[model samples]
Target: MTTDLVERVRHRLAGESRGTDPIALAEAVRAEAGGALSHDAVLAAVRQARDEFVGAGPLAPLLEDDTITDVLVTAPDEVWTDGPLGLSQTTIRFPDEDAVRRLAQRLALAAGRRLDDAQPYVDGWLPARQGRIRVHAVLPPIAANGTCLSLRVLRPVTHDLAALQAHGCIDATALSILQAILKHRLAFLVTGGTGAGKTTLLSALLGAVAPTERIVCVEDAGELRPTHPQFVSLVARPANVEGAGAVELPELVRQALRMRPDRLVVGEVRGAEVCSLLNAMNTGHDGGACPLTELIRVFLQVRRVAASFPCHAFSG
Candidate 1:
C-alpha cells in the first residue's frame, strides 16, 4: 500500500499538473486507490517523498543558515539552533515521536545507512540535498525520554591558516611555531578539549606542509579535511549486524605506516593505537601527532619506556 501510494505521488509530481496542491494530489490518488490516507497523512507522505527525492527536508532552509552551528530537536515540536549570538528556538516541529522517527529513518536510509529500534542509535555524516549532514539519533530503552537528534552543518568551503589566524585560533607566533615544527620534522602533539578546534588546527598546520610530501591520515569518523595535494585518507568502520567484518582505527594506523607516508596523522587517537603511534614516532616517524590528551598519553608512555629501556632517549 505504501509502495503504491508512493508510486501514485511520484506520477502526479512527475506529470506537472498545474494548480494541483501536492497534498490534494496525494489525497485524490489515495481515494482513487482506496487507501486510508487523511490530509495530514497525505502531507506527511508528500514531504517524506520530496525529501527523499531531493535530499533536503523542510529544515534545509535553516540548515543553510551560516550563522547557525547546531540544530537541536528536543521533540517533534521543539527545535533550537545554536550560534555565535546564542540559542534561539525555531518554529519547527515533527508532529510526534513517530513522525520524527520516520523522518530520521528516511534520511538515514537515503544516506545508505539504517536507523530503528533494534539499532536504536546512529551517528554519521549525511550527504545533504543542499549541504552536509552530521546526524546523531537515540531511540527508546537506551533513551527512556525519547529519541534525540542533533545535526551539524559544515560550510561548503573551508578556511585556510591565515583565515584561522585572523579568527584567533592561532596567532602569528603560533603559526610560525607550527611551521618550524613541520619544517624540522619534529614530532608534536595538538591538545585541546572537545570542540576546541583540534582538527581545524591540525588541518591548517598540515596545509602548511610542503605539497611534495605525502600525508596519510587515518580516522575512525573521517572528519579531517586537509587542503594539501598529496594526501591519502583511510577511515575505520564498525562491524555489521551479522558481525562479518570491521576495520578499526588501530589497524588503519598500522596500515598507514606501511603506505610510505612522509607524515602520519591519526585523527583523535582513543584506543590501544597509542602504543603503535609511539612506536612509530620513536622509530623515526617524526611529525607524528594526534589530539592533545592522546599525545600526552603517548609522551608519558614514551618517557616511561625510555626510563625502562635505559639506552632509549629523545635528543633535543
Candidate 2:
C-alpha cells in the first residue's frame, strides 16, 4: 500500500511547483491521489515526499526556524518543538502513521541506514548546516504506538572561547580554569543534561588546542567539528541490512590510537568500548577525553589474583 502511494506521489510531484508550500502540495496530492488512500493518508504521503525532496516534509519550516532547538513527533496528528521559548505544539499534523513511517525510513536512508519492522528503530545523523541534526526513530511494538521521532540540532564547532562567553555558557573565571586544564593537557570529561551546551563548549575548547598537537576523534556518529589545524576522526558504523561490515566505536578507538594522535577523543564513552578506552588511557594514553552526558556504569572486573588485568587482556 505504501509503495503504491509513494509511487503515485512521486509521479505527481514531478509536475508540481518547486516551491516549498506543503499545504498546497498536500491539497494537490489529495486531489490527484483520490481514493488512493484516505484523505489524511494522501496528505501524509505528500508531506513525506516533500520532506525528502523539498524540506524535511512536515518539519522543514520548524527546522529552518532559528529559534527551535528540538522537534518531536508522537503521532501522525501531533507535533511538538523546543526552541528559545521552550516546548510547544504546532498546528502541523501528519497524514497518518504510515506517513510517519515513510518519513522515518526516508531519514534513515539519508544517513545510509535502513529502518523497517525488522529493525524497529534507527539512530543516525542528517547533514544540516553546522547543526548536526541527530535523528532517532522507532516503530510499533518497541514504540507501542505510531512512529516516534526526535530531532536535535547540534551547535557547530566553530565557536571559540569568546563566543561561549558571549552566550553566557561560561564566565571569565570558568574560562581561565578550563584554559588551564587544556594548557596542561589534562584528560577531562564534561557532564551536562540535554541542551546544556556540552557539545558547543567542547567544540570551542578543542579549537583552543595548541596547533603543534595532533588530535584523533572516535565517535558513534560524525558530529564533532573541531577547529584544530591537525585533526582526524573515525565514525562507528552499524551492521548493514545483511548484518555485515560493522565498525564499532571501541575498534575505532584502537585504530585512532595507531594513528599516533597526540590526543585521543571519544565522542561519547558508551558500552564495552569504555573498557578499551580506559585501558588505553590507564596504560599511558593520558590525554584522552570524552563528553559524559549521562553516567553509565564501567565494570572494571579484577581478574584472578595472578594475572594482572592489564591492557594486554583488552581488545576494542
Candidate 3:
C-alpha cells in the first residue's frame, strides 16, 4: 500500500542531510518498489512521504484555511476546527494512534521542543513562514485517549475598529467607548473567556493607535499583528530540554520598557509578569493595555484590588 511505500522511503531517507527534494523521494520510491509502481503512483508516494516527513501530514490543508483559528485533535479519528462559524468536526483523521503520535512528535520537534516519555507535553509555536502558528501537544498517559494536538493558526490580518464592527465584534456604543479610551491613553484590560475575541479586539484597538507612537507588545505567543508602522513585539520562549535558553514574559516587559515604547501591550497576563506590567503602567507607561483570559476570576479580583488604589491604577 501507499503507507508501506512511504514508510520504506522514510527509512531510506532517515538521517540523510537533505531537504524534501522531489527527485530524491522519487528515486527512493522507485528503488524501494523496484519499478513496480507506475510514474503516477511514484509521484503520489513521493508527495505522501514528503508530507509524512516534513509537513503536517493531514492537517496542512486545514492550517492553510485562514479563517480557521483552532485545530484540535483529541483522538486518532477525532479532529475538530473552530472558526467564525464556531466549533465544528472535520473529516480529517489519522491512520492510527501511531500516526497521531508521530505527527505530534514531529510538530513538537519542528517547534524546537522535544516530546517523549520524559517530556510528554510541549508548548511552542510551529515553525512556519507565511503566518503564525501556536502548537501544544500532549502524549499518552497524560492525554488518556492517544496523542492530543492543538494548533492555533494565528491569521495575519489588519483589523481596525471599523472592520471589527463590520464583523459584529462590537457595537457603535462600545466602539465609541474604545475610541475614547485610546484617545485618553488609558491603561485597560480586555477580559473574556476561552475562544473569546480578546486578541482580535486588542489587535484592532492597537492598530488604531497614533502612527507616530511606538507600540511594543510582549506575548508568550506572537499572535498580535497590528497594522502599525512602529509596532514591535517580543515573544516569550520556553526552556529547552536541558532547561536553558528560556525567555520569560517579565524579562521581556522590562526590556520593552527600555525600548522607549509609546504604547506598552501584553498579549496576555499569566504569571509574575503581572507585577512587571503593573510597575510599567503605574510608573507612567501610558497607553498600556493587555488581554486577560487565564484565571479570569482571579484576574478580576486583582483588577478590583488595583482599582482601589489612589491614582491611575489600570483604569477601565
Candidate 4:
C-alpha cells in the first residue's frame, strides 16, 4: 500500500546513514523489493524523504517553551532567550547565515510581511507556534556586526481588578473618584509615567462602565481588553512593503465616532489626534477619556488662559 511505502521510506531515512543520497537510498530499497516500484515511484519516494528530513527543524520546540519571553539570534551560532529571571544563553544553533536568513524570511512571510537584503529590517507581530512573535532584524552594513534578530513573546491575560487592588494600583479614595467620573460622564484622563499602570487604570475605569452602553476602543498594539458587554476594538496597521497601504489610529478614531459610540477610548495619544480629541470633548463629547499626560496638558492650557485674563472679564 502507499501508506506502507511511505512508512518504509521514513524508517530508512531515520537511520544514521550519514548523508546518503536520497536517490541511491530509494534505488537500494527498490532493488531489495524485487523491482516492485517503478523509477518514477522511487524518485517520488526520494523527494518525500528529503522533505521529511528538512521539515523536522527545531523552531517548534523553542517556541513551545512557556518561560521563554524572547528569542535572540545575533548570528547562526549565537542564540539566546530572555524570560523571568533574565537573558540566558540558548543551545539552539543554525548551520550558517543562510539558514538563519531562511528562517527569518519564512517567519516574516508568515506574518504577512517581507524580509530580504533590500528590505533588511522588519518589525511586526507574527502568529506562529504557541504565542505571538515580535520580530526585529538588521543585516550587513547597517548592522555592522551581522544579522540580528529579537522576538518578544506575549502571554495570555490573567489579572483582574481585585488583583490590581491587591497590588496597590488603586486605593479606596482613587477607586471612588474613578467611579464618580464614570458615573457623571465627566471627561477625565489617567496620567502616569511609563510602566506606571496607565493602561491598567484605563481598563479598570472602562470595566466600570454600564454594560448596556456601547464603548469603542482604538489602539495601536491591541492591549486594551475592557470587560464590558458592548465593546468594539480596532487596531492600526503599518505600511506594507510597497509603502502604499497603511491604517492609523486617528483614522480609526474618526471612524469610531461615526459608529455612535456611547464612550470613546484611545489607548494612547501621541500625535495631532489630540487636537481632534480636544475638539470632540469641547463639543459635547463629555465622557471621552484618555491617559494623564493629555489630561494635564489640557488642564495647564485652561489654567494659563484663566491666569491671562481677570476672572470677571472671563465670565463676561
Per the 3 Å backbone cut-off, how many clashing residue pairs does candidate 2 have? 2
Best by TM-score: 3
Per-model TM-score on C-alpha atoms: 0.77, 0.78, 0.89, 0.67
**Per-residue CA lDDT of candidate 4, range 205-228, in tens?**
787788988988887766676678
Best-first order by lDDT? 3, 2, 1, 4
Kindly list the per-residue Cα lDDT of model 2 for residues 90-158, writing each as its tens digit: 998876787778788888888677899888988878888646688999999899977999888765557
Q: Which TM-score value belongs to model 3?
A: 0.89
For model 2, name the residue pairs that clash.
51-56, 51-57
Ten residues in sequence with the least summed lDDT for candidate 1: 307-316
Regions of model 1 farther than 4 Å from truth: 1-45, 48-56, 111-114, 129-132, 154-157, 293-316
Model 3 C-alpha lDDT per residue in residues 221-282, reported as the tens digit of each score = 88899888999989998888688999999899999999999989988887778878877878
lDDT of 1 by residue, 137-156 (tens): 77776777777778887543
lDDT of residue 68 for candidate 2: 83
Q: Which regions of candidate 3 fall more than 4 Å away from where they truly are?
A: 2-7, 294-312
Model 2 segments more than 4 A misplaced: 1-55, 296-316
Residue-pair clashes per prediction, in order, are: 2, 2, 0, 2
The number of clashing residue pairs in model 4 is: 2
Candidate lDDT scores, in order, read 0.71, 0.75, 0.85, 0.68
Q: What's the C-alpha lDDT at position 195 in model 2?
A: 66
Question: How far out, in Å, is residue 206 in model 3?
Answer: 1.4
